[model samples]
Target: MEMSSIVLRMSPTLITNVRIFDGLSVVSDCGYILIEFGNIQQISKFPLPTAPGWNIVDGSNSTLIPGLIDAHVHVYQDLKFIETAIQYGVTTVLDMHNESEWFKKMKLVADEKNDVADIQSAGLAATVKNGWPSAILRMTAAADATLETRISGWPDITDNETADQYVATNKAAGASFIKLMQEDGCALSLPFPTRPIPTPPLEVQKAVVDAAHRNNMLAVAHALTNDSVLQMLHAGVDGITHSSVEPINESVISAFKDTNAFIIPTFAVHASSSGEDRHTRQRLAADLADTREKENFLGCLHIMQAGYSIQNSYEQITILKEAGVDILCGTDSSEHLVGTRAGASVLHELWLYVNRCGFTPIEALASATSKIAERFKMKDRGIIEAGRKADLVLVKGNPTESIDSLNDIIGVWRNGERVVWE
Candidate 1:
């Protein structure tokens, strides 16, 4: 198992013995991918040496996918998270939070994916002052109980830490795109507001979108609520994150569907087992009873079914599989879900979509690869076939039939470099 210690020069790398799901169809034992430089040179029947000095590796009974792309993850968190992502065969992780200097650093470390998958980012969320990032947007000490008082007393504000300026600066600093969050009535309860929260003022959202669009960039928004999503659509934002769990009015959902805008349900973050937040401090932590998880699950299911497309939330996105609503894979919590299994979360998400939401596995995988390629205009790598990028994963079994097989990952290769698992 000794690979050359000398950093092999990037030439062509051959990955063989895979059960390849080549984007369009799956091939058994005929999985071979070849990569040269940063492109996926070709995918064929057992790629072999046409020239000398090329690197080579044989996969050990692993599931080969297109090196899963977790479209929304916190890339700045820790290198260990990247290590875990690689182990699970994720070749790319998109960071949605934005900042200029941070973007430069993230790019430097992630540019070619030296230690992990290729990393790209959307700068900090463009949100109303005191919105979206209640805690992370700026330093704050307001308790949840005191949240209402703080919102009322606080002026409509944006912070230097996460202002529109920070978002714009990241683009210059090399952000892949810009991300925005819409604050509507639903997010506020009690005196905060009665209905779903309204979106960030249109003019403010426009400023961010216009700036990004003018630069030929894409803008994704945190719009799960009906009104919030409609506002983004009206602003001409390109994409959405989150699927509404509650209902929204019908007319708004129709507008979104007609526009054909993309919605990325960052379901993984929302599905996080209540285990993620130890910070609740024993005082605030809601202890779980035996039936609590089930009750919560049922509650979420009810929300999933709410509104036009579940009240414009499309909460149970799978129900719309027949509607041809293009969905994409994005685990907004990848950094926090760190482990050999975090990469497996996307696969788990696919399962949730199927067992819970009713999408076919093929549809789910498409959400991760092909659909993303189409949405981002990154057509080269999402699929497998001749003349496609060889960024790949070699799994132990066939993913075409059972996505669970993807969880049995044995190796990953990006631009043909056999990503030796750490």
Candidate 2:
């Protein structure tokens, strides 16, 4: 679909929406929301007359939503991947598990490099003392000098003193948030792992969180097991990356709720048949050396079923809402979708919550949008209102009732530019 290039050049553009979700609720018959210099200048009521020098669009039958915020993504991998995001209506992305400063610089490039995804980053990941098994460690030096240079600043800490330095150093250098690889080998189904994994020493976890808090930045922990999640919560971290593996018992669900902890479940790239699933955690057992993979695989199936069943049977989502535990939508999709990514990854996650978690479609979008902004201390964007960022998505249907309708993306606007979706 072709859009007028000159339209964005206008000082003010009006998107007369059919349905607009105004953060907390949907505004039916909302009129055009004025856009100026990539920020929302005004939100006028319906039937308002079109103004001079303004780009006007007819949308009395569609739904207008704030541009989606993908809380987790890897735009820096290829660097041009943000284009895919704009085409799909994701205006903001949190680079959860990438090289921190590199991603920060890449984010700058995306801003000036092209009209693409907005990138934020967590610096070099902080894993356990023996955490984060690197592929680089596996290569042997051609009989002489072996290549073994671990990434610098991957602080291996077991106590508070070391943890403080790790987080503080990352924050001082420029980290959007602190990421914790809270365990190793816990993901038994991975293709390579042959044994059990250990959680980051609870002291180290607590210290890391304390450091982040002291620096005024939130700490995000990559915790997969229920035990690890508990440790993270006890440490007082800001966010837990994923929900504990399935068969989420009432006790575990209640524990999260009790702490008012926010779990941003990235369901797209679940368990890989190969290496670690990118983001948090150390080496995951990939494929298999023996039929041993089968027993663990079946064990995983039981755990997952029980977890998912309990998550649903107990209405964990509804409980989360009731207790005011923020639920954010984060997709661990890679830029190229290598093990994960590509079409509908984030969307698929939203569907899982709506269809499986018992949340209304609007609630699901909120999980990905406002909740992220609010939780991450994002002062700009994430909502449709005056004085907020002018990142908006014009869709053809009311997704509030059915999230599946979000697929009908018509036009996406970021920084007030009408993104060309080809």
Candidate 3:
């Protein structure tokens, strides 16, 4: 499809009378923002007179904040998923997994003028033989499903050399970062893992992290239990994709503070496992008007039957926060995955931080905005500053006062182009 022609005619927009949250904190008074040529030209406390070429918008004292970023997602081939994300004001997604070829194609679209959320992907994550995802696939796929087709394309690393190769291949394929799977599947708290699940040895995981560092890329590990989290911590990974499923103790707190690694936590998926699917679905339906998203939520509800301990995960985050461990927001959403619907679930995550995990509103907002960009090294677009890309959202009320107000999205703009969901 062609890029929207209407955005071409609507440059030099001047949005005035808006409460600006520049990704860190909320501004006390109303302000004005100027957009020109797909970038923020100015942000001012006092309104400036509009020029002839400017399309002025009176925001009527509504909230304007940087468009949200989902720190973790597994985007399959569906491009509409990105569009749905933008409709909910999630402007960028850090994709944790997908095939390299498909990721490259999606990245191209992210660069185009289409009304979709931008993507920075891992391309293909490093896994080992008979590991976490292999077990997940076996459980999800039909009995007649061919194993080779499912696992052949995945990069399976056995030694340091193979681990290095895996990182190199992903970097060459335009990966934004390196993702290493360290989960043993039992951490998922499902009953099917009758025996101990396989995972890469710590040395191999360390080699991959070293290779990624040599490439000047961030290495994020997928860990769900204390053992896996410690293994990845010992490997010196830059970040953890999920928090420890076990209780947070002094040892774990000391390890996190000592390493100074950030965490994504992805509590939405944990909430699904912990039997909060009904509450999640009701919240999504109450806040969003999109029927497609509602239907997707129904599909996700079916995937949440497996029991997992969300209380432990929530406590882990609380302990980590008290220990001053940096946290970033991510939903781990995908069309194929259960428990998370893209775009909308990130807000739910912030809600969890505030209502359950003991985070202030601004801190929760920072996890999805500035902190994500800083952690991922996305230098350009996280804040609503002059010279940043004009990826922004306008909501009806102040989100700083009540995060649920984010659901009242009045408008969205990507690269200075006003996004119309239809």
TM-scores of all candidate predictions against the true structure:
0.75, 0.81, 0.93
lDDT of 1 by residue, 145-180 (tens): 754543443223243333456555666667788787
Q: What is the lDDT of residue 352 in candidate 3?
A: 90
Candidate that would win on TM-score: 3
Candidate 3's TM-score reads 0.93
Note the Cα lDDT for every prediction shown: 0.59, 0.65, 0.82
Worst 10 residues of 1 by lDDT: 276-285
What digit string (tens of lDDT, one per residue) describes model 2 on residues 36-70?
Answer: 76678877775656667778877777888887887
TM-score of 2: 0.81
Runs off by more than 4 Å, candidate 3: 1-10, 141-147, 189-194, 287-308
| Clash count of each predicted structure | 30, 17, 0
